[model samples]
Every structure is written in structure tokens, then in C-alpha cells.
Target chain A: MATILVHVMPKPEILDPQGKAVGAALPRLGFDGISQVRQGKRFELTVDGEVTDEVLANVRKAAETLLSNPVIEDVVQVKVVREGGCGCGGHGHGAGKAEKDLLA
Target chain B: MATILVHVMPKPEILDPQGKAVGAALPRLGFDGISQVRQGKRFELTVDGEVTDEVLANVRKAAETLLSNPVIEDVVQVKVVREGGCGCGGHGHGAGKAEKDLLA
Candidate 1:
């Protein structure tokens, strides 16, 4: 099983109150070096088996139609975080590689 | 500048209404292979400049205290998404290697 991380963030032109709330609170907490903070939603899709192109397309469609408002936000990234288990000795699948391959 | 991705998710024992809603909707949209869908919070902390241990500590603290309720949710993962520009070549600093260093 592999988990796909669909990261949806507010579009640049739109105002993000939630993100701004965090950014506003940062300096008050005596934190430095943090210029801005953007809050977003992450959807974890755990595949029952291997991930395929069709599955990816459906997931993308879900993200676009249900998970987020396309006009107000965008799918910033989509990556496979875990593939079955940790690839201890090349036995586990390459989750990162899978995402790169999908992108390419 | 470096951006830290703080991912917080509900503990296994707790009920995730938001996640359940999505999980239930997947099949309705013809999305197969998605056994479960868990929704979580992703905070992008964009540092003003370089990331330091002090900055990491502060960010972690913020995540623990304000971003999530430690009792019901946990900080599952924290990683550096980007550090400066994409490391296309040797001249560009590594964004991923830095995450490994931090983990180690």
C-alpha cells in the first residue's frame, strides 16, 4: 500500500485568514526567521494495493472537485509519502521515485 | 529561505469526521484503490532566511502548542520542503539532504 499526499493551498491572489492568523501570532511568541505561514489541507489517500495511473487521475479529480475549491486554491503538490514499508534494503518500493516518475 | 512542512494528524484512537467524510465520498466518485482518506493540517513555515536549530525549535514549539492539540493530534512528520532555489546543480544548495541531516 502507498499513501498519496495531496497538498492543497490557497491561491496566491486570494486572502488567507487562517494563514495570516498564524503569521500574526508568530512574532508575538518570540519566534524569529519566519517570514510567513500558509495553512493548507493535506489529504492522505491509502491505496489498498499498488497505485496506478487511473488511480492517480481519480485522486486528482477528487482533490479538484471535493477536497478543495479550485477557484480559491490549488493543488500545490502530490507525492507518495509511504510505499508499503520503509525500504530498509531496497526491498521496499521507492515512494519518492514513484512521484517523480508520475510527474515526468 | 527554507520552508518547513509541519504535518499534524489525528491520533489513531480518535475519530476523524472530516477524514471519514472524504473516505465515504471516494467510491461515489469512482475513485478506486483508496481504502481510506485521512485529512490533516499542513503548515508551511517560510523562514526569513536560513534555518537554524533555534528556528526549528521555535517552529516545533509553535506546532505543538498552537497549531495542533497535542492530546488528540500528533505531529507525524516535519520536513524541509524547499531551501533557497531548486538544487539543479552543485551550485544550488540541497533541499532534501538538509532534511536528512535534520533527521539524523
Candidate 2:
């Protein structure tokens, strides 16, 4: 199976009351250094079968068209992780120590 | 500065209508192997000054008590990245090629 992760955020111009509140609260809780807090959404999905470029592209389109609001947010990063085993069989590269695809 | 990322999800017992809808949309998008789709939130915050254990802990507490819903989601992975020169001067270990602290 493949794990597809999606992150969503509000459009930059839009006021994020949730993010603002959290950002403001951090400083009061002894985290005096935090300057900003922008909240976004994450999704962990397990898809059937092997991962393919076409399927992934479709997932991206689905996310853009239906899942997230691109107007307020700038990026929607999607990473596909091949599951099962810890690479003992070398069933494709596992996520291993890495969590996100920054290059994306 | 440090980047504090927070992920949030609905309590498992509660019905996640948003996640459910996205999960349903995936199969229709030609992703036949997908069994479940759960959505969560992500926050990227740039903190002031250096990264410290106490500040990080406070950020976690703030997230739990005010930012995220701990019931449906089991984990909130936080990673501190010191940004500036890409480790040219080696000012503390940067996030570098990896993202997200899965160990947390």
C-alpha cells in the first residue's frame, strides 16, 4: 500500500483566527521566541496497490479541485511512501527517517 | 529561528465528516487500493532566537492544551530547524535534507 499525505493551509490574505490564537498563546506558555503560527491540515491515506505517477497526479488534482483551498494557501505537498517491511526485501525506498519531501 | 509544526485530528470516536468525504473521493479518482483517508492539520511557526528544550516543551504543551485535538490524533510531531545559511557555518544542525521528526 501507499501512504499519501496532504497538507492544507488558509489563503495568506485570509485571517486565520485559529492560527493567530495559537501563535499568541505560545508566548504566554513560556515559548517566548515563537513569532508566528500558521495552521494547516494533514492527511494520511492508505491507497490500494502500488503507487504510480498517474494515480498520484490524479490525487493531486483531486486535492486541488475538492480537498483544499488553493486560493488562500500556496502549497499542497504530497508524498507517497511505500509500506510493508523495513526494506529487508528492498520493496522500494521506505520513508525511513525522512518525513516530508522538502524538494517538492 | 525554529520552526514548530503541529498536526491535529478529530477524536477517533467522533465522526470526521471532512476526512470521510476526502476518503470517498480518492477511490473515485482511480485510487482503487485506498482503504481509508484521515485528515489532520499542520502548523509551521518560525520562532525567535535559538532552539531550546524548554521552549520546545512549552510549544508542545500549548499545542495540546490550545491548538490541537489529541483525541482522534495520536501524535504531534515537532522538528526544530535552524535556518540562515544552510549549515555553511554549521550553526547547529539544520533540518537539512529531512523534514518532520518521526521519533516524537
Candidate closest to the true structure, highest TM-score: 1
Q: DockQ for each candidate?
A: 0.44, 0.42
Per-residue CA lDDT of model 1 for B2-91, tens digit only, reads 777777777767899999998998788777678888788877778877677788888888878888898988776566645643211111
- Which prediction has the highest DockQ against the true structure? 1
- Number of residue pairs clashing in candidate 1, backbone atoms closer than 3 angstroms, sequence gap of 3 or more or interchain: 0
Q: Tell me the tens digit of each residue's lDDT in model 2 across A35-82.
A: 888787777666678767766766677667666776766444565556
Candidate 1: give the clashing pairs.
Answer: none
Docking class of 2: acceptable
Query: Among all windows of ten consecutive residues in candidate 2 chain A, which has the lowest summed lDDT?
Result: A84-93
